[model samples]
Target: MGISVTHKKLKVELVGFRLSTPKHYKIDGVENIDIERYDHEIFSKYLSILLEQENVEIKKKIDNCSITLLDYSENEISSYAFGKLLVFKSGKRQRIVNEDDLTEGEFKNRDQGLKNEIHFVINKTTGVILVERDYEKIFKASLLNSFFYHNKNFIYDYVDEFNKLNYNKETKTSIEIHKNKLIYINPLPSQDLFDELEEFARIKRFKVTKKVEKKKNHGIDGCAKELEDILNKASNTSLGQNVVSIEYYMDERGKGLEMDSLKKMIQNIYQSHYYEDFIITGTNIDNDLKTLTKDNITKRFEFKIPVDIDGNYVDICILFDKLLFLIQEYIEEHFDLDDYYSDKVRNLIVNP
Candidate 1:
């Protein structure tokens, strides 16, 4: 007797109030919708309708929703499950096709459609709502909960005060205020109010140095030496340092020589000293030879130079630690220090 292997088909269960449009709306139906189409307005409208019908009120508006997706072939399994629900509910089969019927490109397109469909159902279940009204309240509540949960010392200290002000007008005004303080929303700040709050929080008293150190040298050699010194100092501290140096050489009278020099310098750096993990710095980075030489030896090297910010023509390399302690410090100083650093360190450790 021959041994037989039987593969089990995956079953995806999606539960929500079914959307009943006034008229039949064809949504490219898993065969024609591309990834772009899934992100388009039509798909979002479809999602909004499904959400509305399901009585799901999301705290945030459903302007866009990101969904996890599986392979195109797997869509058939989900569709089959959906079809089963439709049949059970309405005594009819939902139109679906097997994966083998479509070409490779078509399969991807179909997969996008499947993702959109699944997202539509999920959005409905999650309860789509506007961010201004619902999400703001939810977010404030979540923040207070988090503050209470983590800051046990503060919570204990202010427990009586917190309880007394829990529902009071003044407390409500302060606590429920949106964008009155910095509000971080993933990649960007939530609003201009949040940005203003960030700026306000960043305001601090600065003490002026009585003596400013004047550089004796002001060219490429000076810049390079200065970079080396900074790296040396950083290495002396807990932060470890790595140096990536670029040197640009050009004769005074050549046309298009500066760009060519930069290109050659970059190529040389890439070919010879391309440290997978290191700080980058450059020499002979300005129009004036004397200035370039002096800068190379005397200036404390920065990851980003003033010239770069001003969009001036210059050759430059950045010197930084392999561990990115400086970058980490910058994030901490400028953003939600603890939370941001913890997340970043977690990612670095995991990835490393």
Candidate 2:
């Protein structure tokens, strides 16, 4: 028999973040520590606290998992760390049958272990942390928090231009087309007026007629005091019952919102008039959501590295070497590290 090995590529995503030091932290005369000052000792101390037994146990949907830093390296410009994540599942009883021998055996009561890996690099000069996208989720559970607490002298500010999508600050214009608009009766007519209308209708056998006496001008503004009593009665009551359908157009291309403030606004406008959808053609709604993409951003901060699939035993050292090589080549060829880092620093100062 011959043996065959298969290799698959796992795409690794790299993200960037800038460092900050909160203004209040300066009250005690403490300044943000430069990343270049983060030598082996400082990083080791932070990692030690992050890897504490209690800190490593993270809760997942189906099982409890532990993450441990397995290997690491550091240089003047960058620092790297790789870790293993193991998920522990309680064993369930299993039945094994031998068809040829007509015998059966039961196995139970053991723990099954599943594993994954996470790795990241910190660019000292840029204050950017590069990490794998999927692994980034695991770090969020506790490791990243603990790391930040232990290293409080510096704060991580997500300054990537694409990250603007997170704060809902992009400009956009919305065009709303209203249907079946209803006129609100001002002054709501008086009780005596209603009684007279009822009597007149009854005498006329409820036939539609223009001969009935009508109320005077009574503009909505002049009748505001009389309508105040009914405002509460009319609130949130399917305000848009007459709206057959709603269509929207954005100045910029984007996806339709299934459930959001817009839908709530529509309902309010239709039912209680709690909100109003104005038809302002040729105007921008500041901070309205605009989709973010590589095409829209000034520069891309993330890069992808494809790795070979090797089950739970992928070598961290080799992976680290590959990442370093790719990053170095990328910097040499296309990336302007200093320029990008300066831009992120400026953005952080402005937004912070």
Candidate 3:
């Protein structure tokens, strides 16, 4: 990447120095001595000598360009010695520049003007430099390849795997549909597939009703009052005992309601003069029916088709007592019920 405008200029401090000496000159107190000269070649040679003697590491390089060095601090050197050497080699006539002079905008622009220019920024604490390169073309090429491969194989592989699993025989389960309700008998449907079915029903203008049963252990009066409250709210009017529906979420073992409770509710509904019909609906009917028959409770009602909001079947049990009278009209209008049922069963078996 190209260096940003803000990073074009670099600032460094002269922290140490080394000297080039005649092999036979036995000198004392030579560490603080200042020398003078005035040529680019001489300056470069003297700087190179200091770098070599101090064992400084070349922290950054930019080809026939700038180089920076870092010396071990324990070597005992001073910045004045290095400056003196620079003054001696470059030329006594050259004026000394302050460290702040290195930060001029003109100097930074000059360094950044060339195309494909590289730069480095060093962390003073660690003596490590960050090397920046101009590699826009290379980065763009690799990015294009990544986008193409991800869009092609990555998506297709997932779809293929999903289809294979959907068709596996061991995972298939049949769906049963009755009236407006759909029932899954064997394997349970996954949440994603169920959501799709719900969406389909929503598009078809169907309303879904879910019957939830509140568990009642001993407070029959409280349960009955609560049920009355729910019915009143749903209908926007007070519902008397007789106008209520008693439903249960049944399992294979039995009806979810106790026999005495069911009887008491039914009796209350029949005695109340505020309503006419008292119907009881249950899911998982096989078990419920077995339990009801064992207990000899024989009240019967027509079953309503239970569908999701999208007009898709969710569960098929007994409908409301009113549906039995409308069955003939319903069948007359929907001639493709058999085909629709078949499709639902096939989809459930494959996707569930």
lDDT per residue as tens, model 2, 1-352: 8997555545454433222221211112333322111122233343444354353432233333334454455544434443333323344545557777969876543453334455666544333344443442433323433334333322122223213322332332111111111111011011322222222211100100011112333222222222332232222212222211113343233332222333333222322211112221111134232231111111123433334543332445656676566545544564356664554323423231
Q: Which ten residues in a row have the lowest lDDT in candidate 3?
A: 82-91
The Cα error of candidate 2 at residue 10, in Å, is 4.9
Per-model C-alpha lDDT, please? 0.22, 0.32, 0.25
Rank candidates by lDDT, best first.
2, 3, 1
Local error of candidate 2 at residue 33 (angstroms): 13
Clashes by residue pair, model 2? 238-271, 239-270, 239-271, 240-270, 240-271
Candidate 3's C-alpha runs over 4 A off are 1-248, 251-255, 281-352
> Across residues 14-78, which tens digit of lDDT does each residue of candidate 1 receive?
11111111111112231121110111112233222333332222112111221211111113222
Candidate achieving the largest TM-score: 2
Candidate 2 achieves a global lDDT of: 0.32
Measured on C-alpha atoms, candidate 1 has an lDDT of 0.22
TM-score order of candidates, top first = 2, 1, 3
Model 1 CA deviation exceeding 4 Å by range: 1-55, 59-97, 103-183, 187-352
Reference-based TM-score, model 2: 0.33
Please tell me which model should have the higher TM-score, number 1 or number 2.
2
